[model samples]
Target: MNKFGVLSILMVLISVLMFFILRGPNADLPLIIIILGSLSLLGIIFAVISKKWLSGVIGVLSNGAVLVCVFFILLAYGIAG
Candidate 1:
């Protein structure tokens, strides 16, 4: 697969896996944020490891997807609370 596809898979997997594995409304929430943060960092690393602009494109798109997810999460929180 291309870099973008791989990156998307990685971040989405982390999001889903973390939610199921760390399901609690206490410390697990912040810990999950940290995990997502790490995935964002990995996106940067992947971009840098590439020899051309393609990797950068993948990183930007992947990070954008994660950000979109985080936005939805915040929206849910605002609505719920």
Candidate 2:
């Protein structure tokens, strides 16, 4: 797997784990979401730079998933408004 793919997978795993671990009544939730979003954004950039079709696709999808998760997390936390 390429670096982008690895990063994407890692981001996905971290976001999923964090979502469960920090689900409710957490003080660090926003900070975690920001960090995860930043990582996901970086993964997307690296995927675009890699220029490998499969890796780029996988990275984009996985990182996008994390971003989506972040959004939902914000919603659940009532912090997005």
Candidate 3:
């Protein structure tokens, strides 16, 4: 596999880990978002540099999904507050 492929795999693994980590009541929203966002950005960058179009698309979709989840979490927190 190429560098982009490796990066894409790593990003997916990290995102999964973050998801599990963020499941607790004491989880930090901003921290989780930042970590996931960084991983997604790196994935996209690697995909672009390596000319891996499919990985690039997957990176975008995964990032968008994570962002959406974060958005809803924040929204719910705001409403509850």
Candidate 4:
């Protein structure tokens, strides 16, 4: 696995863990979301630049996971309304 793939996996895991651990009006939630989103985006960019199928797939999955987590966070905070 390339550096992008490894970092992508780490960021995704950290984001998932933070999503579960941080709940109820935590100030860090938005920061975490931003970090996850940025890392995911970077992963996608790296995948594109690298032009590797595996990296691209991993990047897409990682980005999707970040989006899902963001959706849930917004829903939980009633921001979706």
By lDDT, who's the top model here?
A: 2
Off by over 4 Å in 1: 1-13, 19-34, 41-51
Per-residue CA lDDT of model 3 for 1-81, tens digit only, reads 477766865776787788787768887766776777677667656656656667667766665666576677677767865
Candidate 3: global Cα-lDDT? 0.69
Deviation in Å, model 4, residue 68 alpha carbon: 2.4
- Candidate 2 lDDT by residue in tens digits, 3-60: 7667666666776776677656645876877887887888788778777888888888
The local distance difference test score of each candidate is 0.62, 0.76, 0.69, 0.66
Question: Mind giving the per-residue lDDT tens digits that candidate 4 earns over 1-81?
Answer: 677666656666776676667655545766656766676676556655555678668767776768776767666657733
TM-score of 4: 0.60
lDDT of 4 at 11: 60
TM-score of 1: 0.52
Q: Tell me the lDDT of model 2 at 18.
A: 66
**TM-score of every model?**
0.52, 0.71, 0.69, 0.60
Query: Which of candidates 1 and 4 reaches a greater TM-score?
Result: 4
| Segments of candidate 3 deviating more than 4 angstroms | 77-81
